[model samples]
Target chain A: MKPHPLAGALLIAGTVPIKDFPLLLGKAEREGDFLLVDGQRIPCTQGTAAMVTAAVAALDYLNLDPPMALLAGDVGEGRGSRAIYDFLSRELREFSPKVLSLHYLLPIITPMKKVISAVQGCNPRPVLIADAGSMYAAKAAGLATEFDVFTPDAGEMAFLADSEATHPAYIKRYLFEADSKEVPRLIGQAYGCGNAAQTLLVKGVVDYIARNGEILETVREPDVPQMEAIGGTGDTITGLVSAFLQAGLEPHEAAIIAAKANRMAGKYANPTPATRITEIIARFPEAFKDHLCEWSGVCTVESRLRPATGGARQGGEA
Target chain B: MGLFKDKSSSRGRGLTLFKEVKEALKAEKILKVSGYEVKLAAPPPSLRKGCDLAIEVDLMGQAGVERVLRQNGVEFDRIVSIDTEELEPLRVVKVTDFGDSMMVRAGNMKVAFEKATGIILNVSGGGCPDVPYLHLELLNKKITEAPRPCELGFTLCALMLDRALDEGVRIYEEARG
Candidate 1:
């Protein structure tokens, strides 16, 4: 049988407009952080950092001259999420994308559910990335295993830890205090509860890449002070990982590279809390170069610590 | 939370089974001969609308199973999916009348034909392998003279096409009345 025409295509579904961020596109418009792409507006709400990051990652992938077709859609609130499902269903039935990233859409459960069903209904299923609201929705719907990877921050990890809560905000007594310890606890509980996502990139001061609740690697370097205060860093990491997935890297490798590249980008930018997300996004190419060079042993670590270790960080670097 | 749980029994999440044991066995033999993995299990009481024995197969293999069953003359009650949530009902069929032609739609499946001449014009749908062939076979033929979907189709897709055609004819007759 012939393979699908879109076997390795990259399809990004985000709340943010594709045009709003520099995104390395020729033409764009911003409507309150939403990107206007081909006359359709994509929302870049606080919940959609994952997808926004994915689009940024695609820009870096394009630099590699791979046979990649990047398709982006806006799915903010319920409006775009609703339309996205119908479009997604039609696309899945015809062309099979390599990866489908779901950012935001947490507040609107119905549309996200429909998209999950659509993805499941596809023949050669696409690799799914869920972050922010989409991650919450997938886990809440009991369809978390349907996705390939999840990019969740400490707070979201705490939310996944709570078996009873429908949303992260409702997780009891865990808000604003999602430190590194809760990361594995959340993975263990989520796995015990039947989460099928094989890999999780828990974004934090020390990025932990865990497979089935077992911590595989930790990328803790190039830490930029006040990086947590700056928005879209998590989103950038999700995007970077997605790009690596599209490039055919395994989930663990992708997460490690993505975390290292994102931190490197931050270190190069050296942004205060005031540094805009676009400025950080623009540093991705440089980050990718430095991080890849380090991985390939082309670049020496001038600092005392290596970027990633197979287990937890050796010293308090972050 | 049991997304991948082996709920084939509790949820009736497998191939459609028949009330006739012969049909069920025949389906299993045919599927196995076709190189498909198939097993016979007692139907869950909740979903046992037909026979006692049901074929347990992966939901992903449904289209192939249906085609093989239809080709080998194996009858089934209905395909049961273990949906985690109650699915919204299939879209109600809609009939539209043009003075010389008519169109019928049920979900993604559609049937259109000329009213005055009864010449079938098109059959369109996706996500199923049979619909495209159904279009080829039904198109340009008189609706009354065309081969019935039950005779030609070997899967649920063929069943959907039959529904669209049946609805289209019913609406045509009502308009004539």
Candidate 2:
């Protein structure tokens, strides 16, 4: 079955790097932090470049034609941080995005609430993807349940397990140090406290998808051990989940496909500690082909996911 | 005067029904299974048109809940509007200054900050998972430089902290003057 480019827009909220994305090999632009979307410049404040990079990579995989505007923002420090809330409110109200990804906001409490309010006000509530620092914010703000899915690493899994602690830093050492098999224990603990979201994509050596405290599926194939050293891989997973969800896949299917696609992309990149994240992301388009086939169960390619004239990489900067 | 005011009695709008304990419980289960937000409440004695056990449902879910009840053959009394106006109003926050530090209290949440440096000293209150983290992030940071609690918080506890933080900043500015 051919994958469909999502009709609904994918809006990513997170941090950006100190340089403009689509770097020239080893060189970063001398210009300060900013994001270039289709050659238009937007100020990058609080989000990370890794997040935007991953979202772009996922879009490449999905083959979204004439790529839609990616509304990404940086939550600035101090008084400027309020701008994050204002930005989210304005965009969420106007765009009515199908998927709203909350990623990498500062630990400050004020802006977190504002973002939640803006999201709550959105009509036809978006399928929310919360990851990294945003996961902490969502869980901390007690908005974890409001999100459709949470992508947490092993360490983050421990944080989620500790219902007593607000921050991962405060989570009990035992919980954080527990083995992978014990993940179900932590999921139980978090669920007991009503802290867990509707769906959890716990990413590690093994990626497990759990709904309502029950582990539904686990994706463990094509695991690249070295992918751990490469930062932004988790961010890439969040992006893929958002993109897949926008494409109308259920949370369970999206999580599974994203996990498989990410590992597949890493295998394609064949990275060591030396491999940059960008190279791994570049591989998503091709990696998605095989995975989408697995997802659809039909042998033939659908026109929706067919590569464009110039090919997939031409879609956006990953 | 009666303890409750008679508002609109339109079953098409927000309404809940009270049957016997077992029936009410069954209706609650059926409505919830059908995905209606159902809450158990004691219907005001003055309006005791049914059993003591009443299920309060959101106005939007009224039709769906009624349909489910009808489909399940769950018997219920006429639905009634809740006198929302009689509910207690929001609590007012209080601010206290200790010269060296200041504290603001709103409901279950409190935020304290040092006066001289304008940095936040501590944030406390709420059982939500986010409170301890919010406290960790805000602790020992200069209030003026600190992130607004409202932006980072998602629960009533977080909102209360934001309120306290707002007052703490206000008091800090006053102290400076």
Candidate 3:
């Protein structure tokens, strides 16, 4: 089977690599004072998407056709590292992506339009697990509609469904405040590239995928003790969905694979709580292949997988 | 950029930390299954999710792991080792530790994490783009509501190596009994 040039979402996440104080990720978890990766010394700032983008962009410039990127950044010593977020938004826009995806975000929400414009797309949409602060901005920006989605856990869903916030200051305060605890009846909340893109995906026993006002697929993974608190699990899912977008699978389809893959990967790596993100991404093609083969009703290549291709190093003649 | 910082932490013991496990287990004789990447990890309270990342070794007695890495010429500016719990990366350990349990833990963690990812390749599934896979136990049984209404799934997948192995024993006992 010939592999499509565009596979699911081409994930792009970059992060800062400085004293990753609160969280020591992957190999970073090993060294208490210094940061290590793939068994070598690396600066701690390497954790954020901001720093990671240089490599991703280099890969892209190398003609890597990954459409979605998860620009990640770990906060350094500061009250709020908006600099990292703003820097990512700026640097990422230079890539001129068609659509922007958000996982854990916290820059100015209104400036999303400038981003969509720079990306040069007709209708830009963002996929996120909507948080209390982002919901109103989405609505007011005319992007909070059914086209957008929110992947939150039960608690988040219940919170969003009831038009509530976990805490008044759980996150930093913003202009749009709701008093009644009900999803406020705001004015002129239309769905645009930016408005409705912010969504909340509440991670839980039964995963519920929803958008503006309707529920999408509710994919269920096998129950495992590890699912309870894996950081970047949802981020990985988001990245997976983004990566598959290149293959032309619907967002939901990509999401299904990502969700399942993450779960399965979790199962495979059980007990080792600190699994690196890049390590798992390396297996995407095979996992995709197996999933298709297992679920194929009647097929040869199987409906789940088309030929897997990573181009250049993996197989394609770079 | 304000993603991983939290001041409230006492910088406590990372119970499920696998880096230490890898350091402890390096140099252990192990198997790196064919057509799969190696995963490494450390000891934990329980076998939930594991491995630092797998080093190449042959599942049929260590042929597969080395062959693949060599074949792929996997590049690394460095292959650093670290304490599994604190993530305090240790001075680079020799890559020769395929016979140690700690090494096995590190490599296994990598493999397990990598393997668990991705979607069903079938167009019926992967076509959904970024859909995430709902986790299915590799060896343990788990119940879930299927995509269809009232549809239930009993998966005996997610497993601990010992439990998964014990399951085989239990199956034999039941048949014999």
Q: Write the per-residue lDDT of candidate 1 for residues A217-267, one digit (tens) a residue.
A: 887887774455444567668777776676556788778888888888788
Model no. 3, DockQ: 0.01
Each candidate's interface RMSD (Å, one decimal) is 19.2, 16.1, 17.9
Model 3, residue B100: distance off in Å is 25
Candidate 3: lDDT of A61?
24
lDDT measured at residue A178 in model 2 versus the true structure, 0 to 100: 79
lDDT of 2 by residue, B71-106 (tens): 798988755445332121123565555556666655
Give the per-residue lDDT of model 3 (tens digit) for A224-311.
4343323234444544444444333455554555567556655655523233334343344445445633422222322332322443
**Model 2 agreement with the true structure over A35-85: per-residue lDDT tens digits:** 456564543221234455555555544554322433322222212223444
Give fnat for candidate 2.
0.00
Range of the 10 consecutive residues with the lowest summed lDDT in candidate 1 chain A:
A304-313
Q: Give the whole-model CA lDDT for all candidates, comma-separated.
A: 0.57, 0.59, 0.29
Q: Which docking class does model 1 fall in? A: incorrect
Worst lDDT run of 10 residues, candidate 2 chain A, spans: A22-31
- Number of the top TM-score candidate: 2
Docking class of 3: incorrect
